[model samples]
Target: MRNYWVRIALGALVIFTVGMVARALINRGIGGVRGVVEGSGPLSIPLAFIPFRLGGDKLGTLERVTFERTAPQSVSSVRLEVKLSDSLLARGLEGCRLAANLDSKDGHRRLSESTFWCAPAGSDTALVEYGQAVFRPGEVSVPLYLPQDLIDELQDLNFDGDSTPISEAEIDSLEASTELSVDSAPVLRARMGDSLRAEGMRRADSAKGVPSRMADSTRSR
Candidate 1:
């Protein structure tokens, strides 16, 4: 009887280990963040597991997030809290820190964060944006960083000195499709529900390198 129990325990351990290995292998996508550089400062000396995606679009919104590593843990999904660096903010987030809270590959998307520059010099003003997705089964939020002035200038027809996007109509539709992650991670697309309609079309919060383009798109309004 004693030997039987021992064998059962070992079997369970083996199964668990195999599953964990599979998970890691599938999640290698974390490395897709080719241009970013991340370090485990808040995490334990050795990380049990950390997954985050990097890279940005035209505006540079931090295709990822940052979180603190709670020493270590077994295989599972969790939110790792972390801090943003001044360099990322100044350098324009082309490369920076990344943190995430999710299981293995094909895992659900959760919280994320990053930092970006506000202005050139004497400009300490920075903006941070956070988003969440309430899937049919669960809800998740991704961290984001964008320029305030830029968002306003491009998203709004009045501020929008360009013409690539909506302009004349009443903005009857203000939502996003799966292919459009206008202000979030590259892997995840956003579905902005219809609520942005205002008197004339409220200005939207533009990402860092976006508003300027919007203006450029136009004749300079």
Candidate 2:
């Protein structure tokens, strides 16, 4: 009886350990989801998440809108880019730009406002000729310049009462407005969508002939 009880206890311990490990792996995978913004309109400009390679083949994504301090108390200006689906070009949605309205954490004040212009790789201007020649079919990353003064102000707002110095801060709750032309009036306005991971997983499941939960529920109704 003693030997049997020992074996049962050992089996239970093994199962518990396996469950904990599996839960941790699942949470880690979920937390790795990248942030993305998808456009909505007749000329639907789906913002795709293309893996950016950095420092010799290391792959990553634009997970957040972060502001970094260059010195102890001074911040440097930084530029961020967002990738648009290549279908935009074929669908005659070229010369488009995204105007983002970043609000403060309290949602009472606007932190910074900037526009993302189609800046081709290795080019400074967002001219039609330059942008078309460089980014044709795959995707194009448009750049949004954030000034140093804006970063400094944000740091002051996002700071917590801690001993650790604030080196970086992330801006949340961005409202993106799509303009048909650079510096023109916005044609359509929309908020950023669900996580890139959720979108990718749905696509993968669809490709594998798995019916979506929504579709199944609809059929039952």
Candidate 3:
């Protein structure tokens, strides 16, 4: 019986190892940004083992983000691309979306309080496109995309005839009203979700030597 148990344990180990290696191979083809350096930073998001919708508590936000001016030969454009892992996506997602909070030197304040659907294919990994360029990398909050329904609620907030945008505090208050809480990570908030967006905008605003055609798209805001 002892020998049988040992064999079972060994078999489980082998299966686990093979699964890990297979996941790595599957992701090897996906290329991340080359010039910009990565760091283990405060950027994080709630995660889960099973479908987060099923009460699984887990999170993995930004592993790292930094600014790099020297572009590699392989890098033709300024679009920042980040790859998600296969194993993580396998757990299932309530929804895939992105948010940002950035301040541009040109007096551009970007805040995507609403969630934008980012993952269309539902593949093992998702390619999150900022659709913007970062010219100067700054401290930006990076968080997983908030649930789509939650974002809809934020978007539906009444402006009440005020032409100007709502304050960040109001945004925070709105999020607080939801009373949403996650066991692994703090409930998503506008300020935290907008970190990446703001950083990308700052980079785009400060970026130099970009093509003229691409320039308009990056600076449209």
Question: lDDT per prediction?
Answer: 0.25, 0.28, 0.28
lDDT per residue for candidate 2 within 75-112, as digits (tens), equals: 23233333333333312223333222333434233322
Q: What lDDT tens digits, residue by residue, belong to model 3 across residues 119-157? A: 344431323332231111232222233233323322332
TM-score of each: 0.17, 0.25, 0.20
Q: Could you say which candidate leads in TM-score?
A: 2
lDDT by residue (80-170, candidate 1, tens digit) is: 2222222222223222222222112223121223212212332334432322211111122333333343223212212112223322121
TM-score ranking of the models: 2, 3, 1
Candidate 1 residue-wise lDDT at 86:
24
Deviation of model 3 at 94, angstroms: 13
- Runs of candidate 1 exceeding 4 Å displacement: 1-125, 130-138, 159-221
